[model samples]
Structures are given as C-alpha cells and as structure tokens.
Target: MSAHYVGQIAPNYVHSTMQANSDDDSFTFTVGKLDAGMAILIGDKASLIEFPSLLLPSGVSSGSVVNIRVMRNDQQERRQKDEFDQLQEDILHTFGQQPPKAPALRLRNVTQTSVTLEWDRLSLATATLLSLDIYRNGERLAPIPNPLHNTSTKLSGLDLNAEYTFHLVLKTTAGTLTSPLIKTRTHTISDTSGISVCFGHVAEPELLEASKQALTNMKAKWSDRIQIDTTHYVCTDPRNPGAQEGSQGAGYAKAMQLSIPAVLPHWIFACHDQKKMVGISPFYLDQDPPNASSIKRSVEEVLGKQAPASSATEADTSGSPPPPVEKEPSSATTTQDAPLKSTPFAADDVPPSNKESVGVEEVSSSAPPPPIITTSAPSEDGDAEPQSTPAPPQVVITSSESSDRIAAAAEGESTTEDAVEQTQTTEGAEEDADGEMDEVSLGGPNGDDEQEEERRSY
Candidate 1:
C-alpha cells in the first residue's frame, strides 16, 4: 500500500549532490509531492541541511500542495565509492612503473693498430642491462660485456691503410642509444729516394735544367736495373748558392746550402746482386795534381828502363803472351855448409829473356808510352836545383780492392778486406818478366781493353 500526503513541494536536490554537513553520506527523494514543513532524517553521521526548500525532496506540487517522499541517501554514497575505486586503479596503472634511461656515451684514445671504447657506469639497481655492441665501418662487431660497468675495452687487428668509423650502443631494459660515429685513419709507409747535387755558381734556370737532366738520366739508367725506385731531385739558385730551391727553381730559398753533405761526398751508384748490394761506386772526376810530371819520372827510375818497341810487336803478332813459365827451386844443404851461399838468382839480376824484354818498348808499348824526360844535375851557380828525388808517379789504379771497399762503405756495408789482404800477401809474385808488376787497373770492372774500346767507340 502507498501512503501519500498533500503539502507544498520542495526543489529537486542538486543533481547527484549530498548534504554539506555529511562527510561520507548523500540523499535523494522520489515522492510525488512534499510539504513545505516536511522533515527528512539522514544517517547519524549526516548533518542537517538549513535550506530544506532549496533541496529536492521529491514529487511535484502546485499552490503549496503537501506531499511526502522518502530520501534514499546510500545511492549517492555508492556512486562516489565506485568512482574513487576507478580513480585508484588508474593511478596505480599510470604511475606504478617507468622505463630506464640510456647510458652515458664516451670516446677513448685511438691509434693505427687499435681503438678503445668506454662508457659511464649504469644504474644496476633500477634496470637490467645486457651486452654492449660496437660497430666499425657500419659493420657490427661482437657484443662485449656490460660496457657501462666494464668502462673500457680494446679492439685490435685493424687495417693500417683504411679509414674506420666507430659506434657504441648500450642495451638496457628499455632500449638502446648509439653514440655518434667517430672517425680515424691509419698511416702508411712509402718508398723514397733522395738525390743531392752541387755545382759552381750559375744561372738558376740552367742549373735547374741540368739537375733535372742528370736526375732523369740517372733514373733511366738505374731504376730498372737497380733497387732505386723513387727519386727526389733538388736544385739551388746561383745568386744565393747556399740556398736550396725546388727542381724548377720556383720555390722559396732554403736556409742551408744544397751541396751534398761532405760525409756523403759524391753520388753513390748501386745495383742489387744476389739479394745483396754488390756493385757500388762514387761518381767523381780525377783532377791531375800539380808536379805530376816529376812524380812520373821518379816512378820510371824506380821501375827501371822499358824494353825495345820491336819486342812488344813480335809478342803481339805471335798471339797472346806465352803462358807463365815455371821456375825450378834450387837445392842447398844448409847455412852451416856455406855462409852467404850463392843463389841461382840475385836481387837485381835479370834472365836473358827478361833483359831482352826490358827496353822501354815492353813497359810503355802497350799504350802510348809516357814522354821520355831528361834530368841534369844542379849547377854550382844556382842555375838549377838538384832534381828533387824524382817524385814517384801517382799510379791511380782504379781497380784495387780498396776501391771496392770504399764503394761498399759508401753503400753502408762492410768489405772483405781480409780476403784482399791474403790475395796480395806474396810480394815478389807481383812482378812479370818485363819488370812491370801486376798493377791495380783503374779502368772499371770490365777490364782496361774493354774500357779503351768503349772510349774510342763513344
């Protein structure tokens, strides 16, 4: 059964509203009408409302019709409770977790053989970390241990000729951040040849041209035939002989002179023989020293007179000189048997065959003989000074092993001087029947006859 009452109506309760006095309570009304003086009771915790007319109690009324509607306070409270629970769930889902930040990046010292990598320490307390990856030339290398904790690592076995790019990546719980690429290149070693030349003061252009020509000729003659693969030619100006200019003489002057350093006196020529530096020489010209004529005369006196010219012609026409003659050793009992015993030969004695071959022809006939010179004793009136002991002729035998040793020295090598000394130990064996001993020949390695032929042909 429904119970109703007629009275003045109240305003609708503010939609979904509650009494301000209640901390956790709300109220609603559904009756058809309400009296102006009608009263409602909420929970014991709910406070009374002062403006009952402003609040909605329920049913409609006209002209102060009285009505009664009961208030249901728990609906508003339950709605509020559901909303609070939903808000708590959202807050828990949104603020409960966060992703990890990437590690701090760093670069390490780099070199031709290898490169190093490093990184800042990571927060192990907050996030999980995996391996760190490295890249070179856009290619990924092996992943190393936790780079953040490790701090540094080395990457070796790199190519010296190539350029490389490096990148480091940190693998973390969230994601990775790769460092910007770093670049470096390795250095290379090359083959180089050096040339130095000095000449008297002359025109800059001419000097440069001469130097170029000389270097070009040397390269043409030696490059393919020897180990010299690259050449650097240097020239200097005439006005400032001490300054060095470029090959074309267009560059600035140098502080020091362009002369070959005295330690390296002359140009050294070399060729590779059997994997060893064998042929070597210094290109230099021999200048005739002053008083060379007197020296020549003295040498002739010590060596004795030359044989007649006809004997030389006869020997040549008969073909090569006869093979070496064997001398038989003489037998003697002992020094006790005879003091100053007579030997088969004497210090100055000459065999008949040797004497006949002893005229100036035998010694000088092979090539144009040196000029015959006469010496007169000094006069009392100081007309002439005693001919100085005819100074010995400076026989420049270009072929002595000494020259080979010198050549070896120029090339920064050691010589077999002991072998040369052993070969030359027997002094008397040097002389031949014609009174000339085996002489060091300056004529190059091919022999004197060949050198003469080359000279004539050229």
Candidate 2:
C-alpha cells in the first residue's frame, strides 16, 4: 500500500481494500469459520486454504464469501532497492574507505624521574578495538586503561639523564596501527626544571617570598597548596623543630606521608644561585644544620679548658696566704684534763670587764690546758690573794683542718682521729651540762676573822 493512503490507525488493525488490482490476479473464497486470527476458506477446487482474518474484507464474518487478491508491485520494490544502494554508497564515500588512524602522541611534561604523555582522541572508523598498549624502548609496558576514553597517561620512576623511546600500538579488527616513535631524554639530577614545590608553615615571610622568587628564577613550579605532582615542601628554617612537623598544616603532613621532601627555604635560594639542584639532605627540615653539632662541641671544649685557668688566676690574685699544714694529732694529745665544751663559747658570754682578764692560750697539741686563776679582793692588811681553778678544755683548731673535719663529719665519713675526738667531745659536753661547778673563795681563810675585819672596815 502507498504510504500517502495509509492513515493513523492501530498497529494490530488493517483496512478492507489494500490496493487496486486487475481481475487476472483475483480469486473467490467462501469462509467456512474463523479460528484465532486464521480463516478457513474453500476454493473452487475444494482445496482448503488458511487465510489471515486481519487481511480479509471488513465486516465479513464467519461463513461469509469474499474475493481476495494478492500481487507484488515491481515499480515500488525497484525504487526501494535503488534508495538502499544509494545510502550504502554515501556511507562508503564518507567513512568506510578509511581505516583506523594511529594515535598521535606528544609529551605534556618531562621531569628527572617521570614523563607525562597526551594524545588526540582515537578515530576507529568502523573497526572494532581489540587493545591499546604503550611501548617503551621496544618493550611493551602495559595496555592503556579505557583506551577509547582516556587520552593521557603518566610514566614514572625513570632514570635521570637517560634516553628513552616511546610509542603507542593500537590493535583493532581491521589491522594494527602504531604511532610514530618519540625519542626523549630525562632531565639530569641537577636540573631545576623538574622541581615542583608546595609551601608549608613558613615562619619567615621574607624567606618565603625570597624562596618563591628563587623558584621563579630557577624555572621551577611552586604552589601554596600541595598536589599529587608536588615534589618538595618548603617551610621554616631547618634548624627549628617546628619545621619538621608541628607547625605545618594538613597539606604539609600529607606531603610528608607521600614521601615528598620537606626542605628549608635556603634550599630554593641555593638551587637558584647554583643554577642547578643540590643535595636535600643538608636542607631537610628534620635534620640539624650541617656542622652545627661539631661547632657546639668545639665551643664546649674551649670553655671547659678556660674554666680551670680562670679559677687559678683568681686564687693567685687573693693576698691571704694558705694555712700551714699540721701533723696528725697523736692519741695521747691533750689528755682530757677537764670536761671540754662541745661547742665554742660565745665571746659575748664573758663580761666586758673580764674579757681582758681572760686569756686564750694556744698550747701544743700534746699539752694540757692551764688552770684558771681568780684573784681575791685586797685585804685590810693591803695584800691581794689569788685562787686557782680548772678551766674548760679548749681545742686549737686550724682553718683548713677544721673545714675538712666539719665537712667529713657532715657527710658521716669522718676519719679515725675525728671519731675519737668526737667521742671525747660528746662526753665532755655531757659532763659540763650535768655536773655542778665548784665555788672559788677570794675571802680570808677564817670566816669569823673575815666577818670581824669587814665589821671593823665598815
């Protein structure tokens, strides 16, 4: 049926007459019954023919007689075939004649240890892609992931100052196509072009600015924020502990965890001045500045040697002569003649008038203490009598000896002589405290005579 004659209708429905046909192709049929979508028809020869009920004339129910004709339109069929052939020719001229083109790869970036490559979108024409792979130095590295979608890839851990050859092999249903070989040389270790730095906690603003300027002069890339391609982290002075970690932000920490070197700002300046990359070991934030420990040690050694010399000089300047050394006291020295005072008596204990009268005798170490004398008041007969009594035991201690003894005693490490002296001293102290002192009489021998004399004098 002509498309112009076909009107909007249900897909499962059909019209009664399909086309105008000659009577030569026409036939009469009597419908016996309608079963499902098929109609049983009885032909003139009594043969049974199954016809589609949908193609039968409309309103012709079961048991109805109808004439049906079928014919092929040679003109319509010929026209459709010509149209299909023309469409095939157009496709062949536009796309089918060409095969899949090889990938055109080029270098996006080059570094001391890595390279990044990019290419145009793939053109497969009508061929089915089998695999796309990358090759380096005549060895196949690996197939590209998502070959039809991805257009770039990075190759890393390459040797510095080394030459490399790279190409792409695209495998498809039609044939294999390989890109042109690209020759490249990796940057040397001293090349500053490979440096990509991120700034961390920079304690000195001036230093940070200087470092940034240096990076620019060296043709290196830098950022304030860390990224995947960041090769170094520049921060505060390396001598400071904060430069290693605490003062840094999340980016700095991430860079460290990623194995990126954290260096001082001086490193950038150094590289700029030298026009080449230098060793980062001496510039690492966690490391002490080179030669610092050695310098400190040298200073300490000088100071150590100077201290004793200065002390000796001061000693020599003082005018007082050193105390004379005394021989060790013998066991029999100064036998306990009387109870000795455990501690020295205060000078204030003696009355001002008696101070001159009291004498301190410095005896030999083996000599006993002299007896004390008390003078009697003048008698009416014009005679003064003197009375003698035992005085408290006194020790003649030298300055150096006393100091050593006191120090040793304080430390509970006194020598044997000190122990014996200490024992005697303690005993004497107890006796003085507990025992009564005797009275000395300066009056006349006869008590009655003395009283009578006093009465007469009055």
* Candidate No. with top TM-score: 2
Q: How do the residues 1-458 of candidate 2 rate in per-residue lDDT, one tens digit apiece?
A: 11112122312211232322354445566788887699897766565667777776677777787766554566788898999999999899667798889999997667788877889999998899999999999999999999989998878899889999999999999999999888999998678887888887776555566667667766889987766567788876322323553444676668768788888666766566456878889988767645433333323323343343554576577844433222233233334442222222222222111222113212223343222222233434676533221222222222323354333323332224443455445434533553531122112346557634532332
Per-residue alpha-carbon lDDT of candidate 1 for residues 321-347, written as tens digits (9 for 90 to 100): 323222233222112222221222221
lDDT of 1 at 97: 56
- Candidate models: Cα lDDT each: 0.38, 0.60
**What is candidate 2's local distance difference test score?**
0.60
Regions more than 4 Å wrong, model 2: 1-98, 146-149, 199-205, 223-230, 233-259, 289-458
| Native-structure RMSD, model 1 | 28.4
